[model samples]
Target chain A: MTLKKATAYRLSDNSKALLIFYFVIFAVMLSFILRTTLFTSSNYGTLGGLDASSMIFIFVVSLIFAESFKMLQQNGCSRKTIFLSFVYSTIILAVVMAVVDSLTAMLMDIITSNYESGFFQIYQARYQSMRSAQHFFEGLLWYVTAYVMMGAIGFFITNLYYRMGKLLKVLVSVGVPVFFVIILPILSNLTGGAIYEGIKNFFDFAWGFSHGFNPYFSMVSASIFSVILGGLAFLLIRRAVPKQ
Target chain B: MKGIEIRNLSKSYGEVVALKDINLKFGGDKIYGLLGRNGAGKTTLLNIISNRLFPDSGEVLVDGETAIENDSAQRKIYMMGESNFYPEGMTIRQAFRWSQRFYPSFDRNLALSLVEKFSLGLDKKMKSLSTGYNSIFKAIVALATKVPYTLLDEPVLGLDANHRDLLYKSLLESYQEHPRTIVISTHLIDEVANIIEDIVIIDQGEILRNQSSEEMLKQGYTVYGTAAAIDNYIADKEVIGFDNLGGLKTAYILGEVDNIIPPELEVTKLNLQKLFVVLTNRRALK
Candidate 1:
């Protein structure tokens, strides 16, 4: 019952407005892009497109976390219930968004079937390489994982801001980038670039392990990152007090 | 067994102690007036009980179950804190609907009736209401949520004289109809003196007095007469405070009243407001 209440609260008026705004903007922009690419002679075969829906999904999920946590907590909801409800709502939102994205792509393919549009051709090639069902399901899974990761990160950052004192907040704001941008360079210079080399090597290994390797491994890594961020968010919010 | 039991609850913000080793129990189907000066941990205690702020030292139990993360225990309580917790841009009707979702026992009819009584617009967004109406909205919700225990922190913060009276009457009506425990924290002591059956006085993060209103009233009295007569009458008694205008004077005495009073002196019961002022002032002097 608490979960249900929390979920209902999260999907309140502001969230609904955000969802509508994103969908309307995506649909209008997609139509404009398709019309120009199909009708204009020069841009017909060289059609370029970006996954704008995915970007909107990430932003929508982030805004939901940024606004809902404190409001729900203030309304006498337990932190555990709020976190669990967020998980459930995020899963539902992810599936809905992914399905919409896939349907839009399929519709675009059908509209530009006569012309060999670059964007539609790329999707068709993927559909042929992997069965259409596998392609659509894999795309959905990727979106779901990516959205969850983004949402969890957003929640963690918002919780951190709430939990930090004024002095600590200032320190974090100034210290983090200064450490990497200024202190790291000086340390690298003094130590014959060993620190820089170590950092680069670590990033190289991470990139290769996640993106350059099997797609399944990258999905697992995204899931792991999401869980870690979710755990951190829970810890920060478990005992947080609202500002006076 | 059905009331909220708070055990050794303590909370602090850095060096400032908000609540210190506080142990309090709010039980039974009676109205309680939780009186405290500003910064006396009244709101802090309510927030802790509602799980909006975690206690540093101890636990809160509702009917023998922990209330921290327990939904069953939390559902029995509805706290209308001083802060605005309703979502922005939500109308009063929408708020009522969502409140019903969270608290199944919330009485929509009662809330709507209160809106009519208070002359609050159901279509007005929460953020658009005046301060007094904001408080009225929350108070209406508190009165309508027929939970076992309701904790109200500064429920009448910005209400005027007439609205405050109406709210008090509505509060009494609700309590009489559905006999639930209601704890109210407010500075308007005299206004609620007749309404609250029990009184809990907290000062400087400590429980100074906790007793029935009648019993608390018995602890103090006042004598009015000429300055000389008043001084003479209070010569042998523990006087908490005094007021003087020209030659006339009033002395607030803290203890039993004598059966035989001087014929020239006038005696009256010390009102709750004066008693609160005297007690808190005496503590400050110490």
Candidate 2:
């Protein structure tokens, strides 16, 4: 019952925001299509893809952690219940968003066929590069994995803020970037570029893992990162106290 | 057995202690007034009971079961705290709807009726409501939750006299209709003096006094007479506080009132507010 209520509450809270977001996205796309088709000499049918979806998904996830967590806890929800409900809600949101993105792509495809110039379906044609059933399912997997990874990162960051004291918050805010931008560079120079090589290699590996031809590898890596982040978030939430 | 039992509960915020090894219980289906000054750990205790905050030590049990992270145990409890926990942009009606979803026994009809009685707009968003209405909205929810143990921290905050009176009447009416343990944490002692069955006075993070209202009132008495006579009468007893104006004096004595009265002195009942001030002030003075 706790899980059910928590999920329902989260869904109710965010559903309106999601709807407005989708409506705006659709309106923008439609307006661009109309302006290009009617006013331009040549039809350049290009709709900006699901690139904005990831950012929106991350914002939604952050809202869940930053606000929903405290709200639920204050309303007698246990940490375990909230964490579980958030997981379920995020999954449902990801699936729904992915399906909507796919449907939008298909609709764009239909419109592009009617136009003299083939539509530049950014997400389907450029990003996924395929329209087969297998590719669609793979795209779905990518979308879900990307959403979960970003959502987990958001959740982790929010939990960090929620649990940290003022001193810790200030330290983390200033110290983390300073360590990477200044201290790490100095250390790399002093270490005869060994630290730089290590950092380069780590980024190279991450880039390869994410940009791999086989989407499954990227999906697996994203899932792994999501699990680590989600696990850390759960730990923080378990000990989190509501704001006074 | 059927109420909240807090044992060895201790909570501290760095150098400051919020609750200090406080052991307390709210038993039976009686109304309890959790009286305390500001920062006396009233809200802290309620938060811990509802699992919004964790105690540094000890545990809270509901009907003999641990309430910490226990869904079944927490289900029996409801708390309308000072903080606004509802989602932003949520209307009063939506809050009531969600409350029904969370608390299975929540009475939506009663909540709506209370909204009507209070003249609160159901469509008004929580953030838009005035401070008093915000409290009234939560108070209405607490009254309609139908939970076994309801903890209200500063439930009447920002309320005017008439609204507060109406809330108190509604609370009493609900309690009469459905007998349940209701703990009201507020500074308005006189307002709730007659309504509350038990009084739990907390001062400086410790339980200063915990007893039935009648019993607690019985422990203190005020003697009025000439300053010299009052001083003589309170010489042998524990004098909590005293009020003096020229020759006339009123001394708040903590103990049973003497059966044999001095002809010059007048004895009266120790009101809750005066007694609370005296008792809590004694701690501050120390």
Candidate 3:
């Protein structure tokens, strides 16, 4: 019962942020709508990247650790409850955002046939089916998986920082970028591009873009990605004590 | 069966030992005063019981359930820490709203009434509140929780005299209205002497004294007289503290008072604060 309340509060926190996101999105969409109606001869740009924006928003929201942890822990919640609430909140937020984005994308297309730039259109070649319904369903799943993965990664980063001391945190903050931006490239060059090829091949296999244009591989991979990151996050917070 | 049980609880921070093998039980719906000096491991014990910090060894059980990571067990408890755990940007009203959701037994009306009594601005953000008001706000919420066991660590850390009096009265009122086990950890023993029924004294990471307030106070006393008389009287007795000025002296003794006393020497009953002072003095520590 306590877990239920905690999960509800976590979901409500994300939903409120999601509401602000939609308000801003609608305001932007309304401006384009006005331009199209006022200047019939003018070409209005397509506005259909809500999925990407929502995914980014959720990831940013998941980066919050201190406030959420303090709030839940204050209410007599254990670390287990806090971690579970966070994971459940991420899944629920991803599902809600995916459904809302898919419906909005479809609705806007019906209202104005000039709609484009959705995930379905952006990755049309990756999907075999050309049917709009198939696109909507596939895009929905794809959005959910992407948002879940993004949320997991964001949460993992924040939890890692929370668990680290000042020196370790600084070392990690600089070491991560240095490794990716400089060392990885140098190592890839020294390996005769084998490292890059290996990474690309791994992505191809995980996303199922190589063989049958299958999205199940991406979906399964995303689930596994979330589980692993979530597991590591729990370990980091398992013995975490609040700062003075 | 219905209390917090700690068995061999120990916690250390590097070379500093915060708590050393503490075995205790806070049972039933009674008010307990945990008296200790600064860094006497009072806060550490409370924090460990609340699961905010992990102990090096031992376990804590609330009622019959382990409190380590059990939500059901935790739901029955609440600890108002010395530090502000709520988000700084959150308003008192927002906190109350969320508190209602988290605690099924939370009394929103009680919180509102206490807020009005304390004159705390409901819409003011946590960061904007003064130290006194911050303590008052958290204290009000803690009282309204109505949980089975409420552990308050430094409940009146920054309150003024008037606010402190009002808080003590309110605490008594709440305790009478709905009896629950309330553990108050503080060094200000005199202020809470009349409020707490059971008193527990800890010093240097160890449990020094744990008993009823009346019984503990009855165990010690002060004898005031000339230096020579006071020294002679306490020589055979167990003396915990002493104060001297010129030829006059005061010796705090821990034992039953004798019926026959020297005419020049005066004997006064020991108060909780004096006993606590003598018991936790540096000389008493190992």
Candidate 4:
């Protein structure tokens, strides 16, 4: 269905309510940034001082809304229809988040730059990492991408729960991540950290690309990983037979 | 006008055969009572026909098209079985909303009316509702969907007697208003006997009986009298089952007893419930 006709809630009012609920929660964090005194137009191109907690807030909101994606599959909505709508909405929501984040960061940068000019000048002399302020820009891009990926993970798990029975589903949902978190350290120790270093280098490049300070190769590497992982998710939805 | 046709359809769960080389056809605007004992494969057959599950062998056809994952064929049929797949935290209204989205023919107004009539609160979360209320909510969803071929597996399992009677009455009213094909797989035989026009009795992974209820009723009757007299009266007929207490005996015979039943024998009519039980029980022993 085309986006114009694809009102997610049209099929059921409950679906509509869910979509709205998700949108509102997502918008709330942006509202906080908008209301902050540091927000200004002059610093639009810079990363301000929003901490990881706020970023995580947006991610959590995205995850909650992703529940509707599973609901669509459960209700026998076609694979193509549900997937496309999900992607469309995700993109739309991401775009909105990007705009809000940029505005908030710019305002904070302008306010902070003006308020503590002397302090920054003195601090800049002693600061070693300010050598890569350009990386900050790339970091913003990484933020949006990571949040969307996190949302995708939530969506995938919900779909998995829908397809598998209780015991297997619970095991897979909890086991896979718990296994990775626990085993990664031991694997790093045994492999002399080749696997660990490779993963770290990958995310470092991703961080560089988001801040617009990374080498062109780093951006390409991040893009490749994003495309491969995102494509796998799309395939999962495509091949999904209505599993109840 | 056409019906679901199954040919050599078989399904197994590990070592047990759920359905064994089953073949049958159901057609037209008739209410079919899919009577079977608990593991007789009633749900499996219905699921396969509705494209909810896959079969290991053979093919099921709806209007001459394969039913496995056929969207158009599935669109013509709706299966509301025992499993209620409504997600956690969804309210009754929310369930209706999602149903309306996926099912093009779903009637929101009708669903709302049923919700009110059943005394189900729209705001009540599905998980919070009692089992009977949950079943009622699903029944409303099925009725409002208004698909041509509606399959309800154990439609009123947890319902109280009054609610069950109300559901039966509403079902008849709905069916009359939109005379479509309805396949009701229910354990409550007597409750649905009067409304069901056709019957398909499944037993031990096979179809024991598939016939018009009228014909089945005519063929199945109970001959009551003294143990010796009832046996003598039904000697020429096929006896599905017999019960004797003290010297009084009642034998459930298959086929008509028009002129042959002795004057001394008391014959009472067999409804769908008795016919289904005897047929299913006999097939089980065999």
Candidate 5:
């Protein structure tokens, strides 16, 4: 409907602002990573380092952007429209970040490698020393995986916000996740190494797209989980009765 | 005939029943005053009719087509809910834009005209606006949507007397230009008495009274005289309510007063506000 489009456009304005904000923050962080030896091309000399940082970065940005999606729905925009709009915004943000990060990484790689080689070759050769095709596909999968999961989390939060009792709406909006954050680490510690290792391994595998670590399977698993969780969340939000 | 027909509708939130076995039909080119006391399911019923909520049983038909999840039916009905559902950061202009997108019939020019008429600042953020202004913004949207079946639940909430009057005028003007089924649920019966064609009094989730305003008025009469005289006249009659001051008394009695009351008694049209107070009070007592 026209209203849905209007809602989406209004929301996209805010989304665009947030996207820019994240872009600036990550760009600055990329500058810092360039100056640090830990992230340099010479260090580790594998796709693992770049993949890890990119996946983590994508995940964190997705989490923050989830807030923007929630704002869209809260603003009298329908949940279904918001869900649909989010897919587009997420992809847009992903593409923007991919371009910006790659450009910055390429520039930094050129300068650093050129200085190390003692040759002022125009458009430094090592700058074009890209990861294998497998790694590129893995990175793409990881990006989509993280974003979809975050979008699902966004829907989940919206559902929880509606399901909460009147008094709990405001409190739970911030409090529930905070409570979980405080509990999860303690629970992991108490549960010991096997559980901790499993959790760590899961994240590692989920983010391990650059090493040809079964990108399709990891993404498919994440997508399935996301769909199931997102569906439940949609149901909850849809049937929520506004309480006095 | 172009109106809403809700049959055997039931809704409950947990153990609290909002509506039960509700059957109602609201016709076109008419203004219906959906009067009810608080928690009497007026909002709940309106929500269901507008497709904001689902019923546990039965169906809501608009022109004989199920309204639930039916886009064509939903497109015809525009609802302004009691609660504030507008986003916080949006300005009046932005809200208008959003409404225009959702309702193809939404008249942006009309919305803008209302904005000007109301002297509302278009760029002021909703969160920054006063509660009254927030309601005004939504009222403007509802009026401008120009949908066939418009249901306004407490449309004048937080509005000042001047704006309320303006709203009534604008509503009447809009209806005259494009006649539709307009149902208003509000406590201000007297304020809307003149414009309301029909009245539906809901009490404790039951339809206590539903009839034409003229018919409803005709069914009851008010007698004013000395306390003793009024008391004597209504002694065996069904008195809806009575008010006494010193020796003066006014008693509203149900049914015709033509042959029952004394010829010396001063009989007059029952003020809808007073009649509602009496009927609802009587219903509550039962």
Candidate 6:
């Protein structure tokens, strides 16, 4: 009962922001269609890769920790309940948003000949070779896991920062992106591309780019990634106390 | 056994200990005053009972169920803490609505009545409320929750006298209507002394006294006299505390008052506030 109510609260609390976000996305799409029809001779496609945008949006949403934890605790929920409710609600959020993005992408595909998405940009050629037309179910399945993976990563980062002090938080926030963007690349150069190849090869297999463009493998790997992060986050949440 | 049982519950932050090997119980269906000085572990204990904090040792049991991370046990308890735990953007009406969702037994009509009585705006967000109204808002929801065990920490932190009186009266009326366990931790002892049925006094993380309020009061008395005689009179008694005003003096003694008062000296009941001050005061430890 607690899990149900808390998850319901988590979803409803975030529904307004998500509604506004979709409103903006559709409004932009409307303006594009209207502009080309009214003012221009040719229809120029609006390439809004909504799946990636949804991933980023869910990531930011997962970063909401302090206030949600406080609210759940005030509502007489235990830490375990809070953790379960969050993971469950985010999974639901990721899946529902994936459905919206997939349908919207298909809708755009039907409306404009020039319309394209990031998913198509990555796998359209491969999918075309494998099948006749765009696969709705396959795209949705992959997007669900991908978005959940994004949410899990965001939750892990939020919990990691919550456990750190002021100085550590600053150092880590600056150091992590710096390490990934600059230091890791420099290290790869020093290692004669072994590190880069290892990463590329791993993703190729994990994302099933090496396995005949099989999306099932990618879904499995994404689920595993999400589980790993969510499990680690549960450890942090277990002993987490509400701080002022 | 059917109440909140704390066994060897201790918690610390680095070198500072908030609670120290505290073992106590708040029995069912009574108003309890959890008295303590500032930094005296009252809030920490309440937080632990409500699963808001993790104790370094021991555990809290609610009706024989562990409270730490136990949803059922936690659901039976609610702590209206000094700090706001509800989200900042939530309006009073939204909070009340959510409270109903969280606690099925929540009294919606009572909450609405409280809102009108307090003259609080239903649409005002928590951040927009004045300090007094903020306390009032929190108090209203807590009173409406109707949980089995309710811990109120500084329930009237910023209320005016009239508001405080109204809250107390409303609280008593509520209790009369629906009896349940109420543990109130507050600095305002005198205001709550009359209404509280039981007293649990904590001093520096230790349980100083735990008993019925009426019985606890009967164990102590305060005597007023001139300096010379009072000084002589208190030497043989258990002088928990004393005060001096030039040549006149007052002594707080802990024991039965079997004998009649001396002709030169006067005696009165030691109210909860004065008793707490002397009992927790460092000098009174001797």
lDDT per residue as tens, model 6, B1-286: 6999999999998999988999999977999999999998999999999888899999899999899888898888878999998888999989988999999999999999988998999999999988899899988988999999989999999999999999999889888899999999999999999889999998778898999998888878889999888987777898777789999999888887738677889888876787788777753466
Candidate 2 lDDT over B1-286, as tens digits, reads 6789999999998999999999999989999999999999998999899998889999999999989998788888889999788866788888888788778889888888899999999999988988899999999999999899999999999999999999999999899988899999998899999999999999889999999999988988889999999888887998877888999999888888788989999888887898899888878999
Clashes of 6: 0
Per-residue lDDT of model 1, residues B1-286, tens digit only: 7789989989897898988888888999999999999999998888888887878888999998988877788889898889777766778988888788878888999999999999999999988998899999999988999899999898898999999999999999999999999999999998889999999999888888989999998998889999999988898998878899999999988888899999999988877888898889889899
Which wins on TM-score, candidate 4 or candidate 5?
Answer: 5
lDDT of 1 at B276: 93
* Candidates 2 and 5 compared by lDDT, better number: 2
Computed on alpha carbons, the lDDT of every model, listed in order, comes to 0.78, 0.82, 0.86, 0.68, 0.69, 0.87
Which scores greater on DockQ, model 2 or model 6? Answer: 6
lDDT-based ranking, best first?
Answer: 6, 3, 2, 1, 5, 4
Chain A agreement with the truth for model 2, given as TM-score? 0.81
Candidate 6: RMSD to truth: 2.7
Position B190, candidate 3: lDDT: 84
Q: What is the TM-score (0 to 1) of candidate 3?
A: 0.93
Ranking by TM-score: 6, 3, 1, 2, 5, 4
Candidate 6 wrong stretches, greater than 4 Å? A43-46, A128-134, B223-253, B262-267, B282-286
lDDT of 2 by residue, A20-119 (tens): 8888878876776677666664756455555356556555556556568767875678889988888878777777877777566556555553321111
Where model 5 places Cα greater than 4 Å from the true spot, the runs are A1-14, A26-128, A131-138, A164-193, A197-217, A242-244, B223-238, B242-251, B257-267
What's the residue-level lDDT of B267 in candidate 1? Answer: 89
Best by DockQ: 6
Model 1 segments more than 4 A misplaced: A13-15, A37-53, A63-67, A113-131, A175-214, B224-232, B243-250, B262-266
The CA lDDT at B160 in model 6 is: 100
Which candidate would rank higher by TM-score, 2 or 3?
3
Q: What shift in Å separates residue B207 of candidate 5 from its native position after superposition?
A: 1.3
